[model samples]
Target: MFDVIDFLQTVGQDAQWRHADTEALAVALTEAEIDPELRVAILAGDEQGLQALLGQDPFCCLINPAKPDEEQEECDGSCEEEEENDNDKDKENDKGRG
Candidate 1:
């Protein structure tokens, strides 16, 4: 998973947001793909809010925003399982062809 704090640092360093104001930073974060709540907290300089928001898996879309502290880890597990199944199928096909 990508580091939320690192991503935020990169965003802050980007030319577009280099000298951006609070509103601009918020817009940039919104456009960057994740929810705008984190941006809102950052602009407001609310450390606790930022930490709380970051606690959720930011990259996961299935995350229920209502429960920001708990991550829906099932998605990751299911994805890995699906990938393994695909690999196994490929191996079986190779064996059949051989």
Candidate 2:
């Protein structure tokens, strides 16, 4: 089996490959010795099909950190509150043990 990840990386890095026509992409996929099913999925732009073939589930996660200068005070207040609550819980547990 051809390395699907490497094939994807090659296509991703090359604008020409990424924008190639279906016929041209089919030729390239043939040259790359890609799996027939994967070639079909790529040609059809089938994200779910590609994921199934690659044994991957559709997943996305994004994290945007707050600006330190602008959000620091807000974060500090909430974080300190959570810490104090946790500390209180710990103290309560310690009293129970004693």
Candidate 3:
């Protein structure tokens, strides 16, 4: 997990306007760190909460977007499982030869 204080400190060093308010943000991050559910909720929002917390626009795919692939889900590594089976067969052949 990214530490909010460290993130804020880095932002403070890079931007002048940020340096002034990062101290406050650091304190807010302490509370945010303790409450993971709140943090997840905040991260799930579209823009307003993200802009306030991260100082940038949030582009969440869940919000203000079209459903491009409602039916299609990403394939999990089933192909790799098949490849591993092939490897096991090769190992068995090697053992027979030895």
Candidate 4:
């Protein structure tokens, strides 16, 4: 798995392989012992095909702190639940002090 990933990184960074013709790229892939399915996907420049062959899709999440005047987007309720839990803990502490 690491070798395959390394080969892909090398191909991406190295201009020789990046700009190579299909036949040359095919030969390079064969020499690198990359899986035939992966080789086909790479040669065809099919990103979705590669993801299908690998059995996973890319996932990403970006988070930024809201500015004072900016409205925050609603999430899936977990954040709200966490804040409520924290408020409950603070109330419990107040009761204990009393």
Per-residue alpha-carbon lDDT of candidate 3 for residues 2-98, written as tens digits (9 for 90 to 100): 5654554564576654444544544565655634443443345334654555556556575555477666557799988999999999999999999
Candidate topping TM-score:
4
- If scored against the real structure, what TM-score would every candidate get? 0.41, 0.58, 0.24, 0.60
lDDT, candidate 1, 75-95, per-residue tens = 647888999999999999999
Sort by lDDT, best first: what order? 4, 2, 1, 3
Name the best candidate (by lDDT): 4
Instruction: State the local distance difference test value for candidate 3.
Output: 0.57
Could you arrange the candidates by TM-score from highest to lowest? Answer: 4, 2, 1, 3
For each candidate, how many residue pairs have backbone atoms clashing (under 3 Å)?
A: 0, 0, 0, 0
Which portions of model 4 miss their true places by more than 4 Å? 66-98
Cand. 1 Cα-lDDT: 0.72
Q: How far is each candidate from the true structure, as Cα RMSD in Å?
A: 15.3, 11.2, 13.6, 12.4
Give each model's whole-structure lDDT: 0.72, 0.86, 0.57, 0.87
Error in Å for residue 37 of model 1: 2.2
TM-score of 1: 0.41
